[model samples]
Each structure stands twice: as structure tokens, then as C-alpha cells.
Target: MFRTFVSGLILLLPLIITLAVVAWLGQFIIDYVGPSSIVGHALTTIGFSFSASQIVAYVIGLIVFLAVVYLLGLAVESRLRSHLSQFLDSTMRRIPVIGNLYDLIQRFVALMDKNDVEGLKSMSPVWCFFGGLDGAATLALLPTPEPIMVGDKAYHAVLVPSAPLPVGGCLIYVPAEWVQQADVGVDKLVSIYVSMGVTSPLKIPPLPGPGPRKGNLTAT
Candidate 1:
């Protein structure tokens, strides 16, 4: 009975959680722009009375945001995007609670857009030690005109994210000689990490050995 209940929960939990999140987000937006809010007053003054059906307005706002993003992506040089991104980043940084979150998100976005495996090829790994134990190591590149004490070290960096969620992790200085290039790609690495040992490309079972010879099998 316990097993059956657990199995049912496993099947239903994702659907339940998804609906709950959707409901919460919808209510949050309604509260943010409802009749008593500043946006509500402005819209009302403009002869547009807000209603519960204005959820469609929220969807339209999302569509407009996506459309603007698409248009920005189509720009030839990305100069416009850079300027807009900088402006947004600056504004986000001014918001107290959201500033730190935005900065972390920005860093990840910049890394994904700008960094490549080849760029990581010449980098090395920096080992972090704690309580006489090796905690973690990250591949990274360093900047040039290297510090005199660290004069010979290469100039480049790569952040090595922790398991489960690769979004947050330590930043370390990696030398050019330390990082070992792998045949597996980043997408595969992400899958391996997210699945938390349940999935692995390397776990393919070996083919069974050839059957015993006919003469040897005859005795059996």
C-alpha cells in the first residue's frame, strides 16, 4: 500500500507543482497590477478599465517582451544589444533584493555567450583545499601582464560549477597546463550533473562474451 501511494505521488507531483506555480505567478501579477495599483490607475485614466480578463494583457506583455528580444537578436553588430544589456544591468543592480540575483544571472549568460571549449583549452585547474582535504578544483584562464609573483601563470579563467545545479560555484585560477580536455561536450556534462548519477553516457554495458563453443556446450 505504501509503495502504491508513493508511486501515485511520483506520477502526480510534477503536475500538481506545475499548476501551483502557475497559479501563484498569475495571482502575483494580478496583485501587482490590480485596480488599486499605480499601473491600474494609469490605465484607468487612459480610458482602459482593468478587469480579471486582463490576464490576456499580461500574456500580451510577455509576447511583446519576447518580440523585442527577437528583434534585438536580429541586429547585425550586437552593438544595440550590448548597450541595452548594459542599461538593463545597471538598472537591475540598483534594485536591492534583485540586484545580486541579476548579477549572478548576468555572469552565467556572459559565460555561455562568450566562452568556448577552445578558450578553456589553454586554461588550468585551481584546487581549493579545506581542512587538509581537497575541496574542489576549477578550470580557468588568467589575464595578462601577470602579477610578478605569479608572473609566469597564464591569463584566463573558467568557473567550475558544483553538482546538481551548475549555476553557482567557485571561481578559481587555472594554469594553462592543468586542464585535461575531454571528448564529452558541455551538454552531456550538464545532463550528467542534473541527473545526479542516474544518467551516464559511460554506463553502457559491455556486450556479452561469445557463447561457449558447441563442443563445450554439449556436455552441459
Candidate 2:
């Protein structure tokens, strides 16, 4: 009896979550278009002064917002606007702490944008071993090919994401030989990480490089 109840709950959980999300979104729209909201007041000023229905207000406001966003996207694609955007971006990056935060956020957003053809598609998934410890390997993304040169030696820059939340983690430069490509897609790796290894592969693949190095894998 207990087993049956558990199974039933598992089956219905997704549906329940979906409905809850829909309900919350509906309530949010209603509130956003309520009498006291900025959109509501704007609508009144634009000769929609007689419409008291929240639904009507919500539909109109949502349409207006979407249209504005669409137009802005089109404007950004224009050559003049594109150059202006680049200039603005460069100006923002000249700031102190805010510049650093902006860079981090930009990288994270680019990583999450699947539709971005030239974004993270360039990143390679890899299993990185620090100190040559086979058991202490971390899944990471190699975002660039340019190696960090130290005198004659070159080290690869890698980002090791925190499980369940890839946005937060360490950025380390390691020898290219210490990092081997992981046999998994970016989206799949994200799922496994977010699941805390629960959805991990049954068997991990071997590292791509040749035989192991004789000495420990040092960062320098």
C-alpha cells in the first residue's frame, strides 16, 4: 500500500509542479497589470481609461512589452546600434568591481543560451585532474584555445563548475595534458551535475591523452 502511494505520487509530481507554475504565472500577470501597476497606469493615460478588467489590462501590457522587446532586438542587429552596443560594453568593462561582476554574468548567460550559435558551442567538456590525482577529477569546460604561457610552458584555462549550479565555481589554468575531453554533451553534463551525480554515467570513459605523466600535475 505504501509502495503504491509512493509510485502514484511520483507519477503525479510533474503534473502538480507544472500546474503550480502556471497558476503562479497567471497570478503574477494579474498583479503586474493590477490597478496600481505602472503598466495599468500607462494604459489609462493612453486612452484605455475606461477598461477596468484586469485581464484586458494584462493582455495589452504583455503585448506592449513583447513588441518593445522585439523592436529592441531588431535595433540591436543594426550596424550603428551594434557598434554603439560594443562601445557601451567596453565602457562598462572599464568600471571596477561592477566590471568583474558583469563579465562573470555575461559568461554565465552565454553558457546558458542554447540558441546562441557561436557562444558556448566553442567550449569543450573535459575531465580535469589536479595534482595528477585520478580519483580527484573534476568536470570542467574549456572555453578557449589560447594557452596561458609561463616562460616556455603553456597551461590551458578551464572552468570547473559547482554541481547543481554551474554559474559558481573555480577558474584554473592547468597543463593541457592534465585535462581530457569528457565523453558527454554539455546539456547532459549539466543534468548530471544538477542531479548531484544521481544521473551520472554508469562507466566513466578513459582520459584522452597518452600515458600518465611521471610527475605530479602542477598548476605552474
Please name the candidate that would achieve the greatest TM-score relative to the true structure: 2
Quick one: best lDDT, which candidate? Answer: 2
Off by over 4 Å in 2: 1-88, 96-101, 211-220
State residue 31's C-alpha deviation in candidate 2, in Å. 22
**Superposing all C-alpha atoms, what RMSD in Å does each candidate have to the true structure?**
14.5, 7.1
Model 2: lDDT equals 0.70
Q: Positional deviation of 19 in candidate 1, in angstroms?
A: 14
Per-residue lDDT of model 1, residues 87-198, tens digit only:
8879999999899888666645443443444323322222222221233333222212122224754422345666656655665544433333333445555555555545
Residue 130 of model 2 has an lDDT of: 76
* Model 2 lDDT-worst window of ten: 211-220
Instruction: List TM-scores for all candidates, in order.
Output: 0.38, 0.54
